[model samples]
Target: MPTEDHQAFVNELVQEHGQRLRSFLARRLHGAGADLPDLVQEVYLRLLRIPDVQTIRSPRAYLFTVAIHVLHQHRLNLASSPEAVDIAEALPMLQARSGDNPAEQVEAWDRLEGFYEVLGELPPKTYAVFVLHRQYGYSREEIASQLGLSYAMVKKHLAQALVHCRRRLDAME
Candidate 1:
């Protein structure tokens, strides 16, 4: 099919069924479906990448088929993921043992809040890069390979995470 025709076809498919497809993913993904927009975008990107949209006799079938593949991959990624450490819980242990006072407690809580705020601001993929690189000690190349991303993308994510963390921590000071 011509590029314009193929684009129009994909656009029409999305316009017609995007909501249904998103709900399908949300049902399957549960909590992880918070990134439903990104997942939906990935489905669209995959559909657009097809060399010949004509080959897909049924666009609905093709759309759902791609969505299922995306969801399956999502499950696989989660299954392979390492458990993240709960730093908020662990922060108290690192504090000065003698200072069981209110002021010290507040300081620790503020620190934990700052940490979580920074982490919460990141996209799930960017947060994954931070944890994989900082907590799990994976090299950039390894992270890229495992996540099926480019090395440069890994670096960009890591940098954004670091910058955000630094700014948040600085504000906490």
Candidate 2:
């Protein structure tokens, strides 16, 4: 298909069936449905990567097939990783530990917020590797497979992220 025609076809599919697509993912994701947007985006990204959208005779069926694959991958990520506390969920626990003092609570919140801010400043791939390994407990091999990086490159990005974070944290003090 011509590029313009393929794009129009895909856009029409999204406009017509986006809600059903989201519902399908949300059902499979269980309570992890907060990631609905990301999963949806992943499905579209995979669709865009296909060299010949014309070969897909049934676009809606193909779209759902892609969503199922994405969901399976998402489950694999969650299952393979150890129990991991999302940082947003952890912030309240940190506040509780800092006690009832308003000033201490504020300071604790500020520090955690600042730490995440520093993380956000890293290069995108580096940040992803660090989060998948440290925050989600993914093995380097798994991260390399998922992110399409070499195992050595995953290690490199992770190390760079750590060093960058450490320097920023020390400077913050």
Candidate 3:
């Protein structure tokens, strides 16, 4: 059960920030075909469900923090489920049809595969930071707090990982 004050606080926060939140989600989820407004509403609902969350000083930051976690979980859930192979089959055709030479296309795919492989080889913590910051558009501060790491440490890990990825891809060419 939520307290009346907490409920009221949430209501006010939603009213103030709802549009901004929707826009944030829309940019992040561009072309995903998901309903950005619904996702923003879900984040608010989750915030309401969290015990004593109203005690936080900056509720807007807390909302974004929760929203990031919710988005990550949603993506993981979707990845775990088996899906149709239509997209997979069409990917090569799409790539080939794009205005590029055959060799350039192959090299591009190879570099991408190498990048994924290098990412997999990274330590879990480093890889999480890299993915959150690079793939998911999280800021260094947000990644540091979410992973319980220092900002400097996150920066170091990300820089080293990027260097390694670039080196690996260059070596392949």
TM-score of each: 0.46, 0.46, 0.48
lDDT of 1 by residue, 112-172 (tens): 4356445656665676777677756789998888777899998998899889878877877
The better candidate by lDDT, 1 or 2, is: 2
Candidate 3 clashes between residue pairs 3 or more apart in a chain or in different chains: none
Per-residue lDDT over 1-173 for candidate 3, one digit per residue giving the tens place of the 0 to 100 score? 76787688788878887777777566555365475666777787887787776467557656655665555455444433455111000000112232336566555544543455555456556656677777667889987887677899989988987888778768866
Question: For each candidate, what is the lDDT?
Answer: 0.67, 0.70, 0.61
Clashes of 1: 0
lDDT of 2 by residue, 30-69 (tens): 6787899999999887887788877875577568667766
Query: Which candidate number would show the highest lDDT if scored against the true structure?
Result: 2
Please give the lDDT score at residue 19 for candidate 2. Answer: 93
TM-score for candidate 2: 0.46
List all candidate RMSDs to the true structure. Answer: 18.2, 16.8, 16.5
TM-score-superior candidate, 1 or 3: 3
**Candidate 3 lDDT trough over 10 residues, lowest sum:** 84-93
Candidate 2, superposed: residue stretches over 4 Å from native: 84-173
